[model samples]
Target: MSTQRVFVARLSGCFVFDPAGDRLGKVRDVVVIFRKDDPPRVIGLVVEIPGRRHVFVSIGRVTSIATGQVITTGLINVRRFQQRGGEVRVMAELLGRKVYLNDGSGTAVIEDVAIERNRLGEWDVGQLFLRRPRTSASPFAKGPTTFASWSDVREQQNPGEAQSAEQLVATYSDLKPADLANTLLDLPEDRLIEVAEELPDDRLADALEEMPEEEQVHILEALGDERAADILDAMEPDDAADLLGQLPEERSEELLDLMEPEEAEDVRALLKYGPDTAGGLMTSEPIVLSADATVAEALALIRRHELHPALAAAVFVTLPPYETPTGRLLGTVHFQRMLRYPPHERLGAIIDDTLDPMPAAASAAEVARLLASYNLVSVPVVDQAHRLVGAVSIDDVLDYLLPDDWRSHDGEPPAASAHPTTATIPRRR
Candidate 1:
């Protein structure tokens, strides 16, 4: 249950000690702990011999890093540490074990340490504070959960600056999604909902999307229908639909009713597509430009339409009778390439005949194969007549081929096959 932190200040004068308490070098600037409080806790000691760069030794590991001579349980354990003192130097030997109280967490490990001396006359101890795990690694070691930015450490130590979960609701909006996600992961689910309730819809949506699925669902369910609707509408339709799928039918219906008609319809359409298939997983709101327009005209149309959630890689081109069976899909063009063509160039001239698009009905395996072979993010779907129906976004295909649990964890598509209940493909007109 020993915790760890880095020594930022000098503790021992240049001196060396052999594993058997033998003098090595004069104790030099030894890294010491920074305790803002009356009684600063000694997390670890960094011992520096003249020829040696300071290496941290945990306070737990040190029998003592005090004056007269530096003593450590590890120095005795390792044979090379013995040496006589030359010039006196502060040395804090940080090795072996140390104890720490981080974020009210007991006995965290010291992963990494940094010292910050602010221009404003502020000094902070930066420690990659560890979290106590149910299963301790190497008897005790901090892993991913123990990571901490200096600012986080600062916030934790300054009781005056720190706020309770209730008081910090407004502050949740201040954090970036990555930071917020980490913070939320450490907080209770109920506290996260409260904080989420206070944030803007955009922040709420991003934060929710970044959270674990169970947490995301908890927030969605806790949110008022209107609040949830606003956040859902602000999210990509595919993401919105995925979150909705995790909800109770009645609640999902209520939130949908609260959403904008256009946004609701977009989500509804995505809901119709199988959660694991392109049609099920694809973004319905793609930038389907007219086949009759010139490249210039089309570009202008695209600029007017702006970014579409499901637009994938190419600007899909449909032949005459764009919606009819006779209206055949021509090809696609990268938006970047479209900007370079002369405005007068006909859309037909810019269309890349080689653009690869897969069928909406294709399996995740098939979609993955096509995606691997082509650079396009989304492949266009064509009916029996080969007319443009919809498109399969690369994200959707990835989602299809991946398992829901892993996809959520890895932020990629699920790896398992389609869900049994996800057969709700869109009906052909």
Candidate 2:
């Protein structure tokens, strides 16, 4: 193998293949053990395989680390990866860390770390990328950045101090909100908060919606009340209500009070219903159109990038008041039906009112049956006055129906016999 230097940031998401060229997984992080007086020694690579299982791949088994790929000896330990004493994940724990330059310069943040093969062929931390602190007042401002030998940095600051997640967030920038939520779940609590604080309100809100209720509460509370309220305002009304329902009444009310009146009102209305009911699971912001709306307008609304897939599958037709709790439910027009008609045709001409809309008080079981029987992506919900209130998407229904711990683990790992497993390697204490 060549003794060339490889940056940790570039190694992320690279494909890991066995000798036969069979792809095993993608590189998620690098594990290293710190040394007393020398640089940290690379021990292994964290590989996320099928089923989202994260397993350990020893560096000794790695034949080569080249551009966009890592060749392994085809021996992998299937056990879930766990951190041991003195062991650290280079990307998760070292990146975004606050450290001081050995020189007179005050403070700097660790942007990336590089590892290189030594004379003995063992990979060790060789270089560090650092950036001067950017003012919080101007978040978009770029700070002066410099590179130094690993030994040039003095020491890392206390973990509790202000830390940046700029590099960490940028590393996984291409992940979907749900996948990002899974990645955040792997971080230590304090580190997770730091990353959450750095994400944009809309992005954080989407990820929070995918997380479990307990995690949602923990992260929201960690953020002060004002910020929590802002995040809630960005979330879907139904999801925000579900999370607030998990908090204590006093704390929930305080956060609700801080939110904008219009957003708060929608959440408050949803909170009035039991969580298992159709009203509780439904989003009040579904694509709603008036009777005279043209197919062109409906298509335009469906074309929105931000609309949820299930919600975009159809358009709800109603009377005058286009917003939720709309005047009167006319019917629903599936996306396919709209495409078959002329763009200028009125939606009412092809409305599908054969299926009755479910009442807000309808039970979850009833909603599920309706969706299954009708083979629908979403079903319209109405109030006592027969006015449209919201629409429950299939995704939300599955989220409620799945086991509580489903998010924690996808399923059991592949049988050990399928992949030759190696004994666990002890880490330095």
Candidate 3:
């Protein structure tokens, strides 16, 4: 069967199907190995399966690459896809690369790459779609975009040339925070900082929350004080407090001072608890509702795209002052139970008060036990006055219970030599 040339950008979201016509997952990226004398050869594909897990599909297993679909030989490697030393992720690492045209027309940014099957039944990068910068006289005008054979261009020679992350950020724009964080971890420090600077405050904050404390501190410090504080203001109160706890008291205080008063207050409250306690693991912004709230209202609030799945599994009912440290801890309403009740029924009527709320000072093990024993996605934490202080989600418990360096063990090995002169930022004193 003859295969037509395909542009990687067009294949980014195309679905992959097995020979049996069973849908597998969407193509997240194409992996290729660059060679010194020959064009880069396509090696495999990164397919994002359910749960946002990325797996590898060898190029040889791909029977066909048609419009809107990719048919595989049904044999796949379920292990997580780990990028090796010489392997390059076309979309993630190559899309925004700077290259010089052979004609000496100055530098152009790579916008897309085209791959075609060779006579030997192998896929190779054959063409490059690039955009040259507009002339200085017309700086405001868009640049001219053109296609050139892969061999007609060479990588930018100057080692100090500034890299722009606009295309790199665009490539991973649709990724979830956790998946985006994983991708960011693979980037060199300089590239990571560039991408972080280009990302929106909220998007960066979400990804930061999913990263390890060390990476979080590195990125937070790399960003200046103002930008760092803005990102903190956008992160969940619990996650912000946890990251701040890793810094010196003085530095932590300085950042908190720069955050918005309301946001800082929540973080400050969480900081008062022991790092391994329930309060420390609880998010100050859980789904809270008044006792008089209707089931329909509860469902609507949880349905919001912004709410985390674990946090949305249940609603906490309070007497009044619906925010954290709410008037009084009333009871909880599981989403499953809410569905069985009439839409107009008050939350109070379906409250599940059987399981007692965990104390703010409860140990990490105690919180885990409560969640496991009760099979609860989240459990409320209360102070001595029996007021709702916050709630701990299963994800929070897992982050604490897992090994400190667990994030570093995700299949990808360390490559210190890959980036010899990475930009360094001093840790907080």
What TM-score would every model get versus the actual structure? 0.52, 0.92, 0.80
The C-alpha lDDT values of all candidates are 0.54, 0.87, 0.87
Tens digits of per-residue lDDT, candidate 3, 308-331, equal: 999999999998898888989899
Which of candidates 1 and 3 reaches a greater lDDT? 3
Query: For candidate 1, what is the lDDT?
Result: 0.54
Question: For model 1, how does the per-residue alpha-carbon lDDT over 112-147 read when each residue is reduced to its tens digit?
Answer: 334333343233354543344446547555334455
| Candidates 2 and 3, the one with greater TM-score | 2
Backbone clash pairs in model 2 (N, Cα, C under 3 Å; residues 3+ apart or in different chains), count: 0
Off by over 4 Å in 1: 1-183, 292-312, 319-328, 353-357, 382-389, 403-429
Candidate closest to the true structure, highest lDDT: 2
lDDT by residue (159-275, candidate 2, tens digit) is: 556767878988878878977887788777778999999888998999999888999999998998899999999999999999999988998899999999999999999999899
Off by over 4 Å in 3: 1-3, 12-88, 100-107, 132-144, 154-160, 408-429
